[model samples]
Target: MSDKFTLDKRLAAESVFAAALPLCDVRLMREQRWFWLLLVPRVKGAAEIFDLSAAQRAQSMEEINFAAKGLQRAAPCDKINIGALGNIVRQLHIHIIARIKGDAGWPGPVWGRGARQDLPPAGQAARLTAIQAALAAGVGGDMGPKLSNLLP
Candidate 1:
């Protein structure tokens, strides 16, 4: 329900997956080392979550909770970390990441903690397919689009 807000100017340049809800936009992280959904409330002209009214804030939290549930079902992760770091994107987005103990960069924070291993073409395709299936079934809809499919 952020119908009154406007889209940010920088949104045009970001890597988008799909619009998951009325006020929620889901996008895949550029690096495919793991599955991470960047969910941002589509509030135009707002630099941060604090800029939203109380109602929008509550709604965003609800959407984020639902998105987290969706991610947990799709990823089947041991631990999930949710964060909204605006240092880089500055778009007031929240990241929900599925993590396992033995995953790449284990026992360490994913941000600037270790090098990311790029997913191979076949592996990436398979992972993406699995994630899509899980999201479709678990989340009751597709997590997002396959932006990688157009990279040929």
Candidate 2:
């Protein structure tokens, strides 16, 4: 297994690069239907959460929570769905999606529900800015020292 961390090709192609947190490299899903964020850990060959060390697990949870709150602030959604189903992309990454009552994949999983509505360049820029700002503000609370310095 490689020790150096590299992003999965599918993920890199499907999402827009965002900021890198202390433990994860944040990516914004290109689909505009839902405000989605992917938290991909920097650990090499980590296919599951258990693949991480105890410190890493704790940091991942904190980063997940931080990302969810930042998404909520940026998108103002009724529900925020979080999951780590590595069925297709066997990388240790968590999905944070903001959902409303009647979104495109409403009442169902966003995965393979319909064609992804790719965000226009302008829309992508706006969303990225909002998300970055919200994250930099540390929406919910203190994100701890490890993460606090990486934002913005």
Q: Model 2, stretches more than 4 Å misplaced?
A: 144-152
Candidate models: Cα lDDT each: 0.65, 0.88
Candidate 2's residue-wise lDDT over 1-152, tens digit each? 65789999999999987788888988999988988999999999899999999999998998898889999999998899999999999988899999999988888989898777888898889999988888877777675344446655
State model 1's lDDT. 0.65
lDDT of 1 at 131: 51
Residue pairs in collision within model 1: 6-44
For residues 87-146, write the lDDT of model 1, one tens digit per residue.
Answer: 866768888888889877687768885665555566546555655455444363332243
TM-score of each: 0.71, 0.92
Query: What is the number of backbone collisions in each predicted candidate, taken in the order shown?
Result: 1, 0
Question: How much does candidate 2 score in TM-score?
Answer: 0.92
TM-score of 1: 0.71
Highest lDDT scorer:
2
